[model samples]
Target: GEAMDRRRSCGVADAVCDATDASCTEGAPEVVQTTRLYAGAIGQATAHLAETRLSWESQPRNIAIFLRRATKELIEPFEMLRDWLVSRYGVRIFVDPAAAEELVPGEATWTPEQRPHLADMIDLIITMGGDGTLLFVSSLFERSVPPVVAFNFGSLGFLTTWDFGKFRSSLTRIFEDQSHLNLRRRLHVTVVQFDEGDRPSQVSEYQVLNEVVVDRGSSPYMAGIDAYVDSQYCTTVAADGVILSTPTGSTAYSLSAGGPMVHPAVTGVLFTPISPHSLSFRPVVFPDRSVVRLQLPQSARGDAQVTLDGRVGPTLRPGDCVVVSISAFPLPCVAPLSDTHTWLASLATVLHWNDRRKQESLTSASYTETIAAARRAGEAEQAIDGGAREDGAVFDSSPTASESLDDRKTADRRRGTRRDRDKAAADGTVARSPAVARRPRHRRRAAAMEQAPELACAETIDDIESFMRHA
Candidate 1:
């Protein structure tokens, strides 16, 4: 009843609807129609394990399934899943021409040339394998991209969120209720070929899900690239290469180049120099709105090449420049409702963030006790030689230590003797011998002051001033 109501409200004619249905006559609300879905697997996997194909006769909603080539092992599971999707959900299925012969057997298939037409009609995209497979699917849709639900079937699944084991539950939730999606920004790259006069002659553009790299392809000499941000000259990079990355790409190649790990939600571009000749030239983060241009200098010793998301692009001559900026259309990635903070969890798992040996902690009480014991031993040794004469029965000082102290005393005595001699010479009195002069001037002054009790009584500056006044 609900299905008929939904179909009828979506502008299915009253002729198609039951005429006796009371709701069809009056105030029936309009409903949004769910349309065709596109699903595909990466072509590069050696063995395709999935089997079973959707039956053409019993399907309801239009669906397209893409595959590379099917091996004997893959044919059963592939067809089984396809049939299940169609029979359970009543979806019409489309297959790729390349794998249609092996998987579908007799079903008519769409070729690669029909991708443009297919892109327009597809309501959603389902990708199997890793992040690379998802990237391939994104490339198919040049214009607006349908939301992608990626299954983790390949190694290093930084982008793929759905697990193969829970595919049924994950798909059920998506179809039953609309889920929160992560909008990952993509980069728009333009390669400009400069003519004889160093003017732009030809332009080629590409979309990158990850980073764009400008590198010295095979030359022994470093790549010399002049970098500019928002038309303002930034710096000439002398390095193996330079990586221009988005926030989503920051965790990819840019992270390996010592760039900051930016969250996917952050709107920014990252510039990371690879093996930079100058240590001062490090990674820089720019606002998403900024236009980044990297040009190969005329003096460059080697041919520099550009790569978009690890896919090699045009090789640059001396005057060629590559312009990179954020694209207006972002990729809508369907996330599993179970794990909301997937990025954080992925960092811990994929990057081995928690893979560390447990460190041994010090026993605080034992450590403190050990330190105290050492200190007490030193004090006990000093106490054993009861404060004796400087050179007799005292704590045994090392020869070097004793010599250092004696030298210091000798220098102080010499200084005191020199001062006393100068004062005696001024007063027309004979200078004392070295033995007699060993006493410091301050000690002698103190003894002289003691002889006059009044001066001795003046201990402070105020008392001394009063004594001086009386004298």
Candidate 2:
């Protein structure tokens, strides 16, 4: 098994695996405009966002507030922000009912059911939590989501870029329409039911901000599932499950499942298997217009369930399937800037992408000697800047100059090397000789503090599933 472990022909041969998935179909339908968001516990993959600069006319009127929890630590700040928005901008504020069981007196609240009526009424949505908060907001408004400003309060805040400490100033700029926006697209997914006659009925439709997962539930046996691309049978998945991800979800579950890190700006879909049975069955990426379907094989032993984002959905009976495609309505998320660096920034802070320890080249003979040499150089420079050291230490103890060349030639003529040394020895005033010049040290590229982080509270991981349940 160890020798057979390889990435040879990982994904389906015909599967699209473009690193920069920029090309779209010529006949692709026009993309819809809406608010976008990032969601998931560990976060999910994402696609390219439609960039837009906020204008004066685009300023939000009625804003909605969402929180990770309603604890004192979370609610107090919400109150202050709500008061400030109402007094300064005179904007109406609405809150999510889930965030607070009992709303503050006189404060308005909203639910996902009101999205249709409140879509226009709520001009801006502000969420404080991890990326999950943003995804919950996405689930609220299936279509035409208002621009959203997400604050980071979760463990890994890739999607929630802004800091809570600077929320006031950030909101000021946002309200002034000086902020940039990235309109992200979500996966439009539908769970359809099938009867024994092969007739199918739509069970539920959802706009998923992250990846859609279909995996074996609590069953002990590995489930066999069939996959389709553009309605064509592609391959069968024999594993815990399979994932269909949006570009936005590329960072979340898709990444964890060994899928490529498709940029949120690079519009595409990802297919990643979870604990796959076949070694060659690898993750795949498809163009934006591509439609994928995952079905259960009739020979499967048990039922598999679908999980949208991180939330569990309907169960998959033997014949049922899930259809996934690019959503026409893209979510417009408020961004700090309109540049590619934002994606790079997220990778750096969240994933520490490409971060590594730099190697050091020791030009000196030994590490201790190198350290001593550096210390001497620093001391010499300090002595020059100031007066001499308090200890009056000598910089170099070697002779300043060698015996004159003419004198050495005269000595050589008078006597050979040994006799010359004997004459100098007899004279008692030995002629001093110069030492060879030392080679200049190469510039040190690394600092002393540049070291790999030390592990803390290094406990042995007993069991991942049990640990998660307890956590």
Candidate 3:
């Protein structure tokens, strides 16, 4: 039988046969019941037309590092992903704040100026830590957001779509053919404090990718939250906290709070309560373009905690309010090659979520076994990196001592030259004579080297100059 679609009017008219399929010729066209199907389709089309379109742009060669500062269990997966990225893309990885020291042991001894530029030049940002670490790194970007691929090694990963085992394959797919695969959506938030009359003040704006949670912190009673949708009073929530999450955050704290699981590609926001005292206080999904305003009652007994994504926000006073809306710019994330539905299905399969049999299987995998597997994976990736290079030049620590000494001497000489130039400039003296400028600091050292015929070193001044320049 052919599917028959029907249309109905909300108030003005009755059900009508919108369309018919000849495949069901034996029976009359089935009159389905829906609210103005054609009109709904038209409206949806117009809305999408008005919404900002996204571009799939090319990304530069960049390396991704999985951060693991928030949780201990995340370290194993992070190391695995790091090794895999380095092996496949030849991209250097940087760990989180706490692990950075161990990952680059010599960084502590090096001056800030002498530190390698790779840290700042890292193109891709990946965080294996919880949402907190992801939020922390996102805030680090002053202007533009770098593509961040988060792998959730924590209890929740609403923003993170990939797990440890599948991440390597997903990443390889992204690097193949130099394609950019992530999609990002950002939220524009405005912090507000009303005047004596409750008028909102226009202030600075910020963009977040995950969610913004407002909560009453450490109080005996629930905070009174008054919500408004585009100036229309929505409801008053008597709860410990309220969460406004993006589609990327639907599976995070929002899910724990009883919110519906929304796919990442869905353009909408989820509003869920942390713990609502009333049964009617269920989670609600709003249109992506809707503006949500949250204000605490002036007569409330305590203050509330407001967090953006996971970064800390100012305490919400009784009369303070926050305005949240879809940001003009979205945080572009590289989605693993799999479509959103496939990723969701894989998440269910890997996490053994919502299924008893799968949960039992997940429980069967021991923590120690997982760690061992991660380590083995990392070692294998290192081997891959060792073999990937065309030229077999390997970096060894044998010459490190000599290299450091030479670097120090060269640095000292540069500092001396800079000081001499500054002193001359401050004194308003004329430029140095050519002979003085060309004078060598180690005349005795040069003489000694020249006298040693068996030194196997060049005696030419030009040769010495060339060596110094190269150093």
Model 1 agreement with the true structure over 1-471: per-residue lDDT tens digits: 354344334222211222233444455454334332221221122021011111111122555555434445445545776777776797666665655776557655566676765544454566655677777665665444556677776679988887867767776776754454566778888999989997888999877888899999887888899999999999999999999998888889999989988877777789999999998998989987899999988888878989887777899999899999977555667776423277887888898866897754466776777777777655644544344233222223233322346544554565556555555556654344465335666664455465445566556544543543344
What is candidate 2's CA lDDT for residue 433?
22
Query: What are the models' TM-scores?
Result: 0.61, 0.67, 0.52
RMSD of each: 18.2, 21.2, 26.9
List ranges where model 1 is wrong by over 4 Å.
Answer: 1-76, 95-109, 197-199, 338-340, 358-471
Q: Highest TM-score, which number?
A: 2
The global C-alpha lDDT for each of the candidates, from Candidate 1 onward, is 0.65, 0.68, 0.58
- Misplaced by over 4 Å in model 2 are 1-49, 56-58, 102-106, 111-113, 361-471
Angstrom error at residue 455, model 1: 89
Q: 162, model 1: CA deviation in Å? A: 0.6
**TM-score of predicted structure 3:** 0.52
Model 2: per-residue Cα lDDT over 401-432, one tens digit each:
33346644544443343343344455542322
For candidate 3, write residues 1-471 as lDDT tens digits: 122211111110111111222232235564332211111121123222112221212333455464555455555665566566666667555444455565433211223452233223555567666566676665554333445666676555645666667776766554443223334455678888666787765454666777899898777888789999999999988988899998767766787788887766677878998889898888989998799999898898898887887778877777888899875444545554433554566468645567763334544657667777777655643543343233333333232222356644554564455454455455543223334446575663355355333433756655544543343
Give, for candidate 2, the lowest lDDT window spanning 10 residues. Answer: 7-16
